[model samples]
Target: MAETTNGDARGASEQGAGEATNPQQFTIQKIYLKDSSVETPGAPEVFTQSWKPEARVELNTRRNTVGEGLYEVVLTVTVTATVEERTAYLCEVHQAGLFTVAGFESNATDQLLGAYCPGVLFPYAREAVSDLTGKAGFPPMTLSPVNFDALYARQRQREAASAESADDQETDNPG
Candidate 1:
């Protein structure tokens, strides 16, 4: 009887240990340049202008579910540089990566995809933009490092605010 009791205790302990273990995973499957374009509309005439280039840069990130536990993140960057209020060059780059993520809650997964993955891809996109600018006869454009974590948090705040506003409107209308 004592032996039976001991065996049952051991089995329960083993089950508890198994239940407490966490199997979390994050892996980078691949990284690549998904798309890119460079245009020098001003060309020769723009080159003659003084090198006082005024540039505008826009950045965006998006994610897609590739398959079970697999995800794709794309970081898009656009740069337009003008000399003397005339267009000198325009560059756009899309850097993408495939990742395998699992064992996390939905919110955690979203953060990983929205912030961490894009952060990982930014350097590649930045380099591509710089290379494209240099190739377009302009100085290499060094993009400043981005804080994706902050961006993600801010985005979430905006979404929450928007939802609250919608809810308020619905409550007021009682529809």
Candidate 2:
């Protein structure tokens, strides 16, 4: 136990020294709901039908650099519910966060902006969706938790595959 404690202390000291050379920083300046919209196109008539509504949910994430070492990440969630051929309710929420990240490699920063930051913002977006739906005279739409890391990995894989295919085509045809 004592050896483990000493080793941990040594590791901490080493990391501290490393941080001094290239200081790493990460902070969330603010998290807010950037935009939201709820529409109930078919109100009284749609509610009269059986409560069997087909719900479709779409989610997307985007990031942009606001300033040096500062970035804005937005998670957009859209939900539409329809009863038979009639529209029930449509809700959209854009949850955004301002993050400051420095001293990290490009890939790390991308991961932070794509996955980690969005992961932090997702719950708020989900809650907003549910709240909006409930307030629109419908049952709360409880959204399932998202696996941002897995989604990011899949997206990266698809991009890499596309690039490889483009490179292969170029090599095959030299015009």
Candidate 3:
């Protein structure tokens, strides 16, 4: 009986040691320019105008799980230039990056995709937008820094509040 117990303990220790030595593996499968467009309506003449151009920028980000541990993050940036309501140019760019994640659970993966990945991708996207706009005969547009983590937390809080309100409404209307 003592021999059997000693063997069992050794087997358990071996299993644990094996698990600890298992390598963490990950790879960036691909990174590509998903989409890009530059529209300059007042192209040739817009460059001659002495008036300062005002720029409006909009940004969006999304992520998709390509495989078990592979995820693709897309950052979309749109910039529009106007001189007192006269459209000068519009440029939109979608830059994407592929990432491999290991040892993270589902919720953790989601947070990484939503916040961390976007944060990593934003700078490249911003630079691309600025370069495109500059080549399109407009002033370089610098994008402001984005706090994706705070944005994600705020979204989660809003969702929870909305769900609670929905539950209350359902209870009030129950026949």
List RMSD in Å for every model shown. 4.3, 6.2, 5.0
For candidate 1, which ten residues in a row score worst on lDDT? 15-24
lDDT, candidate 3, 1-175, per-residue tens: 9999999999999999987786454455666789988998886777788858888888788888887788888988888888868789898989899999877667777788788887887888888888988787667778999999998888889999999999999999996
Q: Return model 3's CA RMSD, one decimal.
A: 5.0
| Segments of candidate 3 deviating more than 4 angstroms | 1-29
| lDDT of each residue in 1-175, candidate 1, tens digit only | 9999999999999988876796678999999999999999999998777788899999898888999999999999999988888889999999999999999999999999999999999999999999988888788999999999999999999999999999999999995
TM match of model 1 to true structure: 0.88
Question: lDDT for model 3, on a 0 to 1 scale?
Answer: 0.83
Error of 3 at 61 (Å): 1.3
> What do the candidate models score in CA lDDT, each in turn?
0.93, 0.94, 0.83
Residue 139 C-alpha lDDT in model 3: 73
Model 1 Cα RMSD, 1 decimal: 4.3
Residue pairs in clash, model 1: none
Which is the leading candidate under TM-score? 1
TM-score of each: 0.88, 0.87, 0.79
**Whose TM-score is higher: candidate 2's or candidate 3's?**
2
